[model samples]
Target: MSKYIPGNQKHLTLNDRIYIENELAKGTTFKDIAAFLCKDPTTISKEVRTHRLSDWYHKGTFYNAKNFCIHRYHCQKTNACGKILLCGIKCASCPTCNQTCKDFEKERCKRLDKAPYVCNGCTKKINHCTIAHKYYYNGRAADRKYRELLISSRSGINMTKHQLHQKDQIISPLIEQGQSPYQILTNHPELDMSVRSMYTYIDKGLLTARNIDLKRQAKFKPRKCHKTQITDRSVFTHRTYSDFCSLDLSSFVEMDTVHSSRESNKTLLTLFFTKEKLFLAFLLNRCTKGAVRLTFDRLEKRLGTYEFISVFENILTDRGSEFGDPVSLETGIQGIQRSSIYYCDPMRSGQKGAIEQAHTMLRMVLPKGTSFEFLTQWDVNLIVNHINSTPREILSGRTPYEVALETLGEDILKAFQLKPIEPDKVNLTPKLIRFNH
Candidate 1:
């Protein structure tokens, strides 16, 4: 803050104002003005000009307005030669011999002494005397505000496959928690999504990769149905899944093995509906006749032997021995005496199309190669219920629960022994379902 004296304004000027310039003419220094004006000594030094001489000022020591203007204009056009045609000349040369005035000005000024040269034939001296400052006016102003877009132009705004995979993992859970992609993107303002990409992520495993949350943690790919079928020498005369050529709903149940980390020593036997696309899973202590028989007994107890056989008129299984002695198991099941289990071809996995399709859905909950040595019967049943309850497009987008209700009526919905409770409430106290490799 500057203090104001009684009547001193910043713009104040008067003919009677202190003559600091006149004092300088008498050899008084700015140190003297600092004491007189009570201002910084630098202020007095700033007000004096080197271009002014005694005669060019008022009272032979103060500034004259006309001379100030003349000095300013002269400084501005100092490079202009007296020749009107040569006002903006690029090279300062004498017209007679093409020699630059800077190189021969000492001798040339003697010859043209009445003109503007400082000395004769002295290039260095003349070079030092010329107003040689070059002015450059940059046209475009510098950008002062810093900014950055998430996607860069040099990369063409395309994300790598790995980055897209990462993004899918992040966005999927938000969608499941009922958050819209638009809302998420609004907050982030950088993640871009197309309608196709959103659907693609949902269709993939992106929605259910986490063990405890709804977030999609990984990208999913559909499991391909193997082209080979199961073959058994003991069932040489038995019919194959190809014998029945119908795509009819409830006609077949696809079967596959869910192994434990216990190598092939223990496994879970999974069954899936062909047309209605329902799932049924059983944990077996061993992949033997007794184990398979016990699994069948449990199915009968849960779904009823009649309803189970009726829903799957035939069982389309792979070549695994866990489904061995179909006729004996059927006889013990106390239903049909004739055999109904059919094996896939020796190398063709596609023959058992129903169960083959089921494997893909099962992978979402229990991934392939997941060991079950420590899983419980209730855990296995919970997984089964989850699969059975999942909605399917083939079933008119109605869940298995809906189709099961439609088929068996609502009265039986609660009656099915395999119905699920909340996932966390599931009590699967690891019962070893062992199997022989």
Candidate 2:
């Protein structure tokens, strides 16, 4: 008689989870990763599929759209929103199409349907692709998620939702103010719970004050601090100046932001096409990452994804924190590929010199210590149009508008309402555009 006895099964440890994460990135198969962890392939499969994060929110990097419909690239349906009669464009190109379109069919990656269900090991997704993309498993995040599930399922100290809310109102504020659990418990005897219970509630996110807020407070138990995870990878991983130099692109654009005086929150986001020396500037309300994203979103909307992808093939910029988030700029919210961003090394603003030269022209009009608060988008457009229409010696006595018309085509220029100004009528002064303020 053959004797086959199964070993005692144990839950996966944090170390095991970390190992799984590393292996998955190396394109290791589930069967191989399972063999090293001394667990069944099914166990690894379940752990990955169940805990794989969508949109990479924990990592601060959202992949292509989470609901990237497979038919988006090829589908010809229109006006899924149904708000307007005879919508101009197809719904497949819209980001919210999947949310409202009745004919939406989610395209699942065939590779994820099998063993390793996450994209950590994906070799094909090197660039900003249009496909619907998601499913990344971070070891620390998976462990945290698993612990929460285990603790919640254990059935200890089951307080009703109402009771939890009442406790949260009192505890969360004190916790936020850096009051230790021990101090709070001793002061508020009416809390009617052990110091450990307060810790548990904060740990499980049952309260408004998070576990992160407890770092400053005196704790009885050893609190292990986990750094906030923005993304599994760095923004400059493959987008350094060296990488930019490696590319033999026919054309490249340099981008930069010009900040106004402290009195005004508004800023100018500028783009200079090196090959043509064509310049475009956008007036932003505040110099923030979100504001920059909004500008990119608006520009992409005006010029469809295909045209945007072609024009902004590669964007070179400085290492400003405002451009820290690149996914939103590179991929449309609907998950379509648009452009790529590369950063120059720190203290190396001269790498993208064309934009620097273009800034000199800008300062001649607005100058330093100027407040952009009074300026409107229309005013900025007028200034840009005038600047683009002026003839330059470097362009062989041709204006940027004239050069752009031949190379980039008039369609993109027209979308932004860029027009020609007679060389005699060209103006580059503070009095160029009339501002409301």
Candidate 3:
């Protein structure tokens, strides 16, 4: 705790990686880049040295591509090929000079030993420079490599199949009669695997023994869900739920996105006003950061800048990838300050109970296991209008539309295409929604 840290535990994003690549191309120092990124200089150096790609194309270097000796340019030696007669070619220009010469030594760039590890910003005809055993940092390629590593590291079994088969050969048959992994491991000292790993192997069907053979295991309840680290932690800087709590604002809206299916692309972006119990939703073609930002842009254009900010002073949401770019969402099109975006704690959906309740109401009209591919914005608006019209018990028998109208006025409700429906006309059933496609 006494040690001073340069940066938090936040992972470097693609943007940061791209910035590193750009700065490296500009011949920037590691210390300066690290300072700008708020990271330790070692981090920047390691990232470059690790992810930098190598290039060793044939004959790709300055003069004397074939002869790579350090003293080739100034050497006066000739007939190094051990020919009886002079080859007439200077030892420096000979293709086999480095191979045939006795005192030849491999030449390497010493500048790559310390900082600016790559040849990006060399300022010496970089594009046309002969590419030898040189290293370069590419933003997209580095990002791709990092993503592949991140995904592969978390998936698949740790043990090899041969070891797994061997372990299974020892542990399976004993359990065929009626022996738990723990009991079997207690008696067998030769087995190298752990009891928990054996249980997992059985659960994954990798072993002959099954979960049904175990005693008292069937009665155990499922374990509680674990929390995953939030994606793109940089976006949550100064925009955490703790920061939101510090404001103590009475009228904040919770935002979320609802997907249809793994195969379908259409989704719904929802916003729930906690004070009025008012719900608003927009149909999105894709559940992506760009799509969410575009939705906010369209809303601002429709409602105007000042009115949009007045309505959405603060937006509290989860750490989904769709909300990764809070900066774009918080900034208005006209370069003015509009709204503030905050993220809820990971795996804590209950933090935004108002939006969860709104989704529950939403599921009533569009239940699970149904396709939303045919849904249109108008169809979604109809569903939302009906949802807002229905009276909520929490609102003291007042509908969301009524509360919204009383507080935000009829003009504001009209801006969102919300209208009051008669008590008899309000339908919570799935039969109310009509698909366009």
Q: Whose lDDT is greatest here?
A: 3
- Candidate 3 stretches with Cα past 4 Å from truth are 1-10, 13-15, 31-38, 57-64, 81-89, 93-96, 99-102, 127-131, 151-162, 212-275, 280-356, 364-386, 389-398, 408-437
Clash numbers, per candidate: 30, 3, 0
TM-score of each: 0.40, 0.47, 0.59
Task: For candidate 3, list the clashing residue pairs, or say none.
Answer: none
Task: Encode model 2's per-residue lDDT on 1-437: one tens digit a residue.
Answer: 11111112468879899999999999998899888777889899999999998763222112224445666666777787888797888775566777998877776667777768888878875454444456789999999999999988986567888888888888989977878899989998987999888888887778898877886543556766431223434888999899999997768989999888879878899999887778899998766667888888888889888888888889998877678778767878579878889988777789888899888888878898988988887888878877888778989988888899998887898876788878887788877754333
Decreasing TM-score order of the candidates: 3, 2, 1
RMSD of each: 35.1, 23.8, 8.7
Better model by lDDT: candidate 1 vs candidate 2: 2
Better of 1 and 3 by lDDT: 3
Candidate 1: which stretches are off by over 4 Å?
1-232, 246-250, 301-305, 333-339, 410-416, 420-437
- Give me the displacement of residue 117 in model 3, in angstroms: 1.1
**After superposition, candidate 2 runs with Cα above 4 Å error:** 1-233, 434-437
TM-score of 2: 0.47
lDDT per residue, candidate 3, 1-437, as tens digits?
A: 11122123367879899999999988889999988887889999999998999876445443576666778657888788877484666778777787888898777666566777788788766545444567889988998999999999988798888987888888888988688788899998677668888888788888887888787777889996442344677888899889999999989999998878656878899999999999999988777777888888888998999999999999999988778778888899998889999988887899998899889889998997667888888888888988998888888898989899889888778889887778898887788875323
lDDT of 3 at 297: 85
Report the C-alpha lDDT of model 1 over 1-437, residue by residue, as the tens digit.
13212223232122212355345434455677556665566544433321122221222111222221212222333223444664553322213212222232221113122211112122443334322211111111101110122124433325577777778667766766866555667666556776455554555545442323323324345676542222457663545655644434335667777666546456677776665566777777665555776666665666666665665566777677556557655653565642267666676777776676776666665666677666776766666676675666787767776676666565445544456345344222222122211
